[model samples]
Target: MNTFHLGLIINPLAGLGGTAALKGSDGVAQEALALGAEPRAAERTRIALECLRPVAERVTFLTFPGPMGADLLAQLGFAHQVLGSLENGATCADDTRQAMRLLQEIGCALILFAGGDGTARDICAAAREGQPVLGIPAGVKIHSGVYAISPRAAGELTRRLVEGGLVRLASGEVRDLDEAALRQGKVSARWYGELTVPEEGGFMQHVKQAGMESEELVLVDLADWLRDSWEEGVRYVFGPGSTLHGLAANLSLHTTLLGVDVIENGQVIAHDVTERELFNLVDGYPARLLVTAIGGQGHIIGRGNQQISPRVLRAIGLEHLRVVASKRKLGTLEGRPLLVDSGDPLLDDTFPDAVRVWAGYREELLYPVGWGS
Candidate 1:
């Protein structure tokens, strides 16, 4: 097997400097508490590091000093080769370039960083023809194809690559989006060229649910089943996706097509509920979570709704919850697996040994819950 050196960088404020939207967390420091927004980046880096722990034995991890990447790795009891020179206050963006240059000089096979779209551009600045990199989706607005579906997905993909999982490497595009236009509630997409993205399994594109015309009828039938099978006296916390939104359309109610919804037996109790609100809804009404994997990415939880905290998941229990995906959607997953963020990290730790994800009514597929080994 060929071993690769993966350099880890955390652009502490890359996404924060963008527009005042919630997707950009770096600028959040100026808007909120003086905690410097370190916790967000720190926690994400920690999550990324935690996922990489089991794979530690498979690859060489090259890293920078404190706050850059080293501190988080050390805290997790992970050993890595420190790449560049380390010094004071860990001046944010300055160190990102320095760390990237050092990784290139050291001949690292790939670089994995965590941040938003700006961080992706930063990598694009120094990325070469054959250099491969991956991003742990931590930034507020990660409208880029360079990112792994989720933090754990990033780790799983890295693990698969190290295990000689026949993977293809290709040049993936890096997009340049207009932050101001997006802030003005407009969509303006521009090309920013391509970077070498290691072609591997499980990495997905967020698209308008694919294979639409063919699966339209099945989707329609699935929607009817969901609305009809809804339990009485129990609340339904529907995560974002067209499939979940289908139930709302059938119920003669409006829902957030791209957000979480809390519904009662027949009415829309609340729309665009957050992770916190979802938990409260479940507690107050005794409910189950109904979610579907993102069309391209095999993620059922932890994509857009950070409001569904871990505390709520434990209260509702995954045993009572249901995961729905169209047959076409399941095919794209390619056995990559499903993920749940559940605000609290520990909940994903204790999920069921296996879950029969509902691909459609009378259609189910069995997949494991926990497997870091």
Candidate 2:
């Protein structure tokens, strides 16, 4: 039997800007740090490794030194080889590139990296043709098709690849947005490059689509259902998205397009609220969270709407959480589960095996939800 050699690389600053609402972590590490943004890439990588525990004995891990990769594996008790060195503080793109080159030189069968689209681009630049790479998503904007839908999904795919299962190698797009433009509420995306990814249906994400015309009717139907099902004196916390915005429109209420809002009795109680403000509002009333998944990405939480923090989710509880998405958006996932990364691992596991999503008026779909690392 041949031993499976997997290379690991982690960009420590991958998702530091998410909850801070800075949009992207590319060049705003210092700003995000000043705003008290914590490093999440390593923790997210640990989630993937936890899922890989079943197959750990059959694999050897090659990783970079310190916070980049080796430290997490060591803590997990996985026997791994540290391939390169880095300074004590702050690992840069060059470190990722160097680690990739070294891993390639040592003939790693696959490389499992933790970061966002920017990290994906760095790996793509260093990877040779036919080299299979997988991404554990831990970024603010993950529009790329090269990542698993969630960290557990990443581990599942990694296990399948190492176990000699029927896995297909496919070319995946690496896309990134201009961080500056994103902070300004303007979406400016560009194709960085392509990477060879290990693909298994329902495990990896598809590239996000621009817009869908058919979703309008579905949104109106869902909005109608919400209007009919309205409970008296119950407060509704609306998450940021076009879907929820349309729902607000149906109620003839105003909403922030990309900011969290509070609605009561079909009226806007608060608009463009922050995390603290959301907590304050939900505490005194019967509240429920209303959110939609990122089309094609399949994330219901912890992507763009970080305003609904884990603290808020816990206060609202899982039963009070409601998800709405069009059938078209669900179809883009190809049966992948809806994802949530509230930045709290314990809170993430509190969710049930599946949750019900309102696809249209009187139409419900039971979809599985996973914690995206």
The best candidate in terms of TM-score = 2
Per-residue lDDT, model 1, residue 46, is 69
List the candidate 1 regions with Cα displacement exceeding 4 Å. 1-3, 14-29, 32-38, 85-87, 184-186, 202-373
How large is the C-alpha RMSD of every model relative to the true structure? 20.5, 21.7
User: Compared with the true structure, what per-residue lDDT tens digits does model 2 show for residues 1-373?
Assistant: 2245688999999999998888889888889999999999999999998977877886779898889888899999987988767777669999988888888777665789999988998998888865668999999889999999998889888876554333455678999998888778888999988887766743222223434536778878888888898888988999989989988887788899899998888788899998899988887678989999998887888998998998889788777787887666767776566788889988877664345566777765445566797
Against the unseen true structure, what C-alpha lDDT does each candidate score? 0.65, 0.81
Q: For model 1, how does the per-residue alpha-carbon lDDT over 246-315 read when each residue is reduced to its tens digit?
A: 7567667799988888878778889997767777777755787777777656666677756666677777
Q: Compute each candidate's TM-score over C-alphas.
A: 0.49, 0.54
Worst 10 residues of 2 by lDDT: 201-210
Q: Assess candidate 2 and give its lDDT.
A: 0.81
